[model samples]
Target: MKTDVEELTPTRVKLTVEVPFDELKPNLDKAYKEISQQVRIKGFRPGKVPAPLIDKYVGRGAVLQEAVNDALPELYGRAVEETEIFVLGQPDVEVTELDDGNQFAFTAEVDIRPKFEVPDYDGLEVVVDDAEVTDEQVDETIGNLRERFASLTTAERPVEDGDFATIDLVARIGGEEIEDASTSGYSYEVGSKSAIEGLDDALVGLSAGEEKTFTGTLVGGERAGEEAEITVTVQSVKVKNLPELDDEFAQLASEFDTIDELRDDVRARLGRQVKLQQLSEARDKALEALLEKIDIPLPDKVVEEEISRRNQQLEQQLQMAGMSKEDYLKDEEKSEEEFDKDVADAARLAVKGGFVLDQLAVQEELGVENEELSEYVVTQAMQMGVQPQQLAEYLTQNNQLPAIVSEVLRSKALNLVVEHVTVKDESGNEIDVDAVQRELNGETGETVAADDTDAADEAGVDEADTAEVDTAEAAEAAEPAEAAADAPAATAETAADEAPAAEPKNEGAKDA
Candidate 1:
């Protein structure tokens, strides 16, 4: 058996394989045995029928065809391993020559990782904002805490900002009542600016038992973007009574006994969050700098699929949120053209980043150990709101473990890049990314070693939000893996970040 690779493009190849008759003998035998069990001969037992007898009953062509189909995947995998070509999508397998007991020749054309030189990853400088927690932010945090403990008291005055109103609403579009546009006894905060457009403006100055009719356009439901006359009746108005920010309030709100102590704790928490933001900034900026330093030619087919997958996922989210695409576009303040461009750019960058890191992982000979995979599973399970066992079972059941392992490898590759790059804050002070990560992980407090500064804990960097729905298909989740023909693309974001790990399910490897 032999295989030769023909380069069709920078990102695709054709494998011409020649297998002599002896190489296919095992597959032929297996096919004969399978067909033997399915057919019943007058005197022959189900599993005891001979190969020649079975072939005489079932045409030799039929057995050969089944054998070829069963062997294509294994043959293609062998070709990939022999050439060390990173295949993207499934191959287009064609049996060019098939003569039983003589020769079997086939061709598989597949998308592959384009070969490119990696730019120097060392000394790449990335600048991040200073990790400064502001007094105003702390005050806001405390105010939010106070709001949680606040009590509501009936107010006998006109509805005002900062007051809560229990109201009933009915919406009619062009005089016909709209379904899903009516709710009773809904509690709303006047200044919260939630629920409907122009709701707060209409509610203000309307006293208890008073009714107001306003013209507005419904943003959701069958009447989305349709002009509607809404009538809102305020059944009762109540004002929030916040507890005083004294020592008593501190004890009630938190474990701290003193107001000053609670404030200090909040400030400390803010400081930690600030550190996390610094880490995220460094990561994004570093990746951007790395991308700018080199040019990567991404495959059009892969990029197009990525864009399509993202659009589909976005549509799903919009449906779940009861929003139309037009409404979403308006809310995001983007035109259709602009949104398309952004998706394209993001998709390209994503693929480029993955390709670069995969190359690094290979060059560095980085391998994902059981320890690393276990740690990642535990961390990812926590983020996905599932037990580690449950998440593992889902991945294993769906054949997604390959994707998860690839994600981990890519993350370590990125971390390796970070180790070589120079990172600093806006003030020109060198930023210790790993140290900041350690603080978040509660690994150390007093001092961090040099290695710790480089091996930034990959967990706790919340740059991307991932929702790991235990769905069977990844096409329904987020972006599918790169032109992953037989395996998933390396999608590790290093921080074991919330990534779309459920890769798309496709087994065929064919060409365009």
Candidate 2:
């Protein structure tokens, strides 16, 4: 077997492979066996028919096709391994030679990872917002907890902000009543700004039994866009009486026996929340730093495929939502040109980030351990609300395990970068993400370094990588003769590889 590669672009390549007849003999034999199982020959048992007779019956071309089909994947994979190209998706294969007992030659063209130098990331500084829990913030947290223990008391005074109003309503569009648009005995919090527009204002000054009428657009149903005149009657107004802040109240609300103790606990909780936020900020900032510092050429075909996939996904979602692209654009306040350009730009950022991380994974010699893969599977399973076994089966059955492993490795690579970056708070004090995480988890040593490899990292991938064809389908082009020969033959189809979660880290001011 001989293989040679041609560099088509920084992100793509054309591979020409030559397989000698000796190497293909095994596949040819396998193909005969496979075909023998299917075709019935007179005076020969099914699957027991000899190769030559069957070939005479089914044609020499048919048997040759079967051999080529079974051989393509192995040949393609071998070529890829030898070339060491970071393939983004599937390859386009063309068989140029099929001389029996002589040689088989084919060409495979594919998108490869872009070549780029990772910028020096050590001590790459990013300022994050202050994570300090202020006294006012503690007070607000305690107040929210207090609200949970609050009791509603009927008030003698008029409706006001913070008052819960029990109300009734009638909606009429052009003096005609809209049935579903009206409700009675509904409990609404004044100044909450929920429900119909202007309803809060209409109820603010109304007393019990006082009615106010206002016009607002209907949100749904037959008269969805029509303006409706709503008449709201306040049945009663009640204010929430929060529990007193004292020892007894503290004991009732939490395990703490004193208000001071409760305040301390609230402050600690707030601190942890902010610490999580800061950790997230640091990770985002680290990735942003890398993306900005490094330069990579985006593969045009890969980008176009990504954009197409996402657009298809979007179209599918819009269809499910009973909307068209035009309707969706109108709803989102975007023009077709703007939406397309945005898609292209976003695709570039994503593909570039992927290339960078993939290179980093290579540089660090990162490998996805079984434990890491198991953890990733568990996490993904939880998110999808399925059992681990079920998710594992699906992923394995679809040959998606490699893609999952890649996802896990990239996460580790991202974490590796973040480990070297300097993350500081707004106060010019360095933010020690590891130390905080250790404190929060009640563990010691280098734990926070692993925080960035979370699935939450992939939150904003609504329009990413939808253009990836099934792995089986992608490989099919390389071995089409075999595919046509099989009658409902089962072949593994690899699912689209998901992008490892990443984003800009410093959207807000540096954390303190």
Q: How does candidate 1 score on lDDT?
A: 0.73
lDDT by residue (42-138, candidate 2, tens digit) is: 8989889998897789988988888998999999988877776666566899999999889999999987766666777886889998988899999
Off by over 4 Å in 2: 156-158, 172-180, 207-213, 304-347, 374-400, 432-434, 443-512
Worst 10 residues of 1 by lDDT: 503-512
Query: How well is each residue in 381-497 modelled by candidate 1, as lDDT tens digits?
Result: 655667676887787787776676567666676777777778898889998777666666674332222222232322442324323333333322322233233343324332121
TM-score against truth, every candidate: 0.85, 0.75
Give the range of the ten consecutive residues with the poorest summed lDDT in model 2.
Answer: 486-495
What's model 2's overall lDDT? Answer: 0.71
Look at candidate 1 and tell me the lDDT of residue 212: 93
Please state every model's RMSD to the true fold in angstroms. Answer: 9.4, 9.9
Best candidate (score: lDDT): 1
Candidate whose TM-score is highest: 1
